[model samples]
Every structure is written in C-alpha cells, then in structure tokens.
Target: MSKVRAFTILEMLINLTIMSIIMGLIYFAYASFVKQVINYQVSIDEQNELTTSYVQLRTDFFNAERIVKSYKGFKVIPYNNKEIEYKITDKYLIRRQVHMLDTLSINKLTISSDFNIITKEDLITKMIVETTLFDEPIEFVIAKDYAPNLKLKL
Candidate 1:
C-alpha cells in the first residue's frame, strides 16, 4: 500500500513558527501606527492653541495706540495715555489697567496665552514676539528699522 501523505511534526512546527512571526510583525505595525496617530493628534491640538493665542494677541495689540515695553514675562502697551500691563503668571496672562472711566481703581482680567506670536513694523522698526505653549521661554527679536524714508544699505 502507498504511504499516507500527512504533515510531519517538523512541517507543522515550521508552519506554526512562521505564523507566529507574521502575527508578531502585524502587531508591531499596528502598534506603530497607533503611536503615530497619537502624536499627530497632539501636534494638531498644540497648533490650534497657538493659533487662538496669536489671534487674540494680534487683535489687542493692533487696537492699542502703542507698545510700551515687552519683556520675558511681562508686557505693557498703551491705549491712549493709560497703559495695559500683561503679566505672565503660572496659569494665565493677567492684565492690569486703570479703568478709563474710573481712574482711581485698577482693573484686572486674566486669560490664557498658551502660545502666542506678535509682530510689529513701520518704516522705522520691526519687532517680533513669541511665546511657547508648555512653559517654554518667550522670545523677542528686532528685525529691521529704517528711518522714515531712509533706504537700507545692503
């Protein structure tokens, strides 16, 4: 009689080993995809926070008459003769101002500046401001300045 054909023990072991390896590879790939997706979501959240901060800062700065000073943790800008001081506290940007209508008492308002960027320019001067989302230090730069109609010398 012809010998019956069947999978030998060695063949079965090899097939099982191959399947385990394939499954491991698939699991690793899926895990990597999940990690990347999480990272992407975090990045998007950070970007949205930054954008919101920037817009609010821009609106406030442009409406003000002038910028008094901007330092690492504090900024003072003038609206008319009165000035608004924005101080960076542990949790929020605290704005202190003497109320225009009532000069005797100081008014305070608090808001978050999770991430912010401010830029200013005129014929004479250019300035930039930036603040990070996660307690990173603020940064400021003076880019360029040209007196009224003076041309920049290469």
Candidate 2:
C-alpha cells in the first residue's frame, strides 16, 4: 500500500515566509488608511472653526447700531448694553465683548476696511479678513449695514 505524502520542512518554511510578506503588506495599507482619515478630520475641524468665527463676527456687526474707528480698532456699543471691539495685533485678530466677557481670536482684517478719518463714526463698515488654517490661506470681505439712528441725540 502507498502512504500519503506529508508536507516537507522546506515547503512549510516557504509557506510561512509568503504569509509573513502578505501580512506586512496588509499592515502597511492599513497604516496608510489611518493616516488619511486623521488628516481629513483635522481639515474638517479647521473649516468649522473658520465658519464659527465668521458667523460670530456677522452677528456682532449686524446687531451693532454703529461702529467707531479708533486707534485700538473698531469699537461698537450695542443696544443690548454690550461693548464690542475688534483689533488686529501681532498677526492675530481679536474680538472682545465687554459685557459678555468673551474674548476670541479671529483671522486678520486687511487694511481695506480701515478708515482714513480716525475720529469719525462709520455707519457702513467694510471688513476684509485674511486668515490661515492648517497652512491654507483664506480671505473674505463683509459689508455691514448699520441703523440710521445710530448717533444718539444729545
């Protein structure tokens, strides 16, 4: 009677090496996929942050009666008893709401919105903001319309 052949040691060793190579390739592919997912998440977060900043800025400006151009920056006294100020300093844009007690960093506002007359109350304000997120540059321009009764009658 003929005996069934068993796998030789050399054949088993070759099978193990092939399996190891396949496993290594699979691991490399998985690592690449994980890295791409992480990068995508980071970009989404940056986009959300930029959107929130612009929304807050629009809300503040829309609710403001008038805006004053000052040496520090643009100042506004809202009818809701809150004083808001916007400033550009050291490559950062800052917004401070005195009554709300909130401070936030917004992107940079370009010089186009700046007024030549420092002492005038500007009813119509234009804002040109340039900012960077995750090494990407973005810019936006906003034109704010103020209420006609902004100047209180003394």
Candidate 3:
C-alpha cells in the first residue's frame, strides 16, 4: 500500500481563521477609503457652492445701477429694473429676487463702504464685501459711478 498525507482538521480550521482575518482587514481598508472619498466630495461641493455664490454676487454688483443698504442686508438695483435683495446672517447669505431665492453658506461676512454720498446717508457708492469661504478669507469691492442725468433714490 502507498502512503498518503492529508491536511488535519485543526490545520484546516486555522487556515480558515487566517483567511477570515485577512478578509476583515481588506474590508476595513475599503470602508475607510470610501469614507474618505465621501468627505472629499463634500468638501468639493461646498467649494463649488461658495464659488457660484461669489460669481453671482460679482455679476450683480457689476450690472447694478445702484446698491443701497437695507434693514436685513442690501439691495441691488440693475439698469433693467430688476430688484435683488441680499439678506445676511451669522451662517448664511440669502439672495432674493422676483421669483427666486439663493442661500449661500459662509463662515463670516462683513459688508461696508469706503465712503458714502455726503448728501444721502444711505447711498452706497462703493460696496466692500468681506467674507470667509471654506476657512479662507476673501474680499470683493463693487463700485458704481453715476451720471448727472441718472436719478437718485433721494
């Protein structure tokens, strides 16, 4: 008779245990990678939102005929007779128009002017918008020069 050798039950069980541990480790690594990817994606989305809001505000400022201080925030009146209002809060900046509303998330915001019209206390000539986006601070300055023929709010 020829001699034969085979794996013992104990050895088989140990092998299965080792394989199970390896699979668990692989699963753990994959799960952690997926979680990190989700976090990165969320950060990118936040950055995009901040950029879009900044662009919209800049466009409105550039096209504005006049910008006036309001109780909540400020008003942008364009040459085309459209009224846009921006409401600022501790954590958000809300933009409202005829039929649309846009809420922008921000860390901090400060709106001011370098100087105003001497005759009109509320007439904002140059708007200085200081805000923090995604932990970085930035500023935007929008100014509108008026012609003698243009009408004043006063």
Q: Which stretches of candidate 3 lie above 4 Å from their native place? A: 1-5, 114-121, 125-154
Checking candidate 2 for backbone clashes, the offending pairs are: none
TM-score-wise, the better of 1 and 2 is 2
Counting only residues 3 or more apart in sequence or on different chains, how many pairs clash (N, Cα, C under 3 Å) in candidate 1?
A: 0
The global C-alpha lDDT for each of the candidates, from Candidate 1 onward, is 0.49, 0.69, 0.76
- Report the C-alpha lDDT of model 3 over 26-123, residue by residue, as the tens digit: 99999999999998998798878878887898888778877777777888888897899999887778999989999876555655542344545354
- Per residue, candidate 2 scores C-alpha lDDT tens digits across 28-98 of 99999999999999989888877887888788777776666667677766777667887767666677765
- How far in Å is the alpha carbon of 7 misplaced in model 2? 3.2
Candidate 1 lDDT, tens digit per residue, 1-154? 8999999999999999999999999999999999999988887877676565556555556555444344433343434555666555444554556642211111222222212123332221333445564445454333332232333321
Query: Candidate 2 vs candidate 3: which has greater TM-score?
Result: 3
Candidate 3 C-alpha error for residue 50, in Å: 0.4
Candidate 2 contains a number of clashing pairs equal to 0
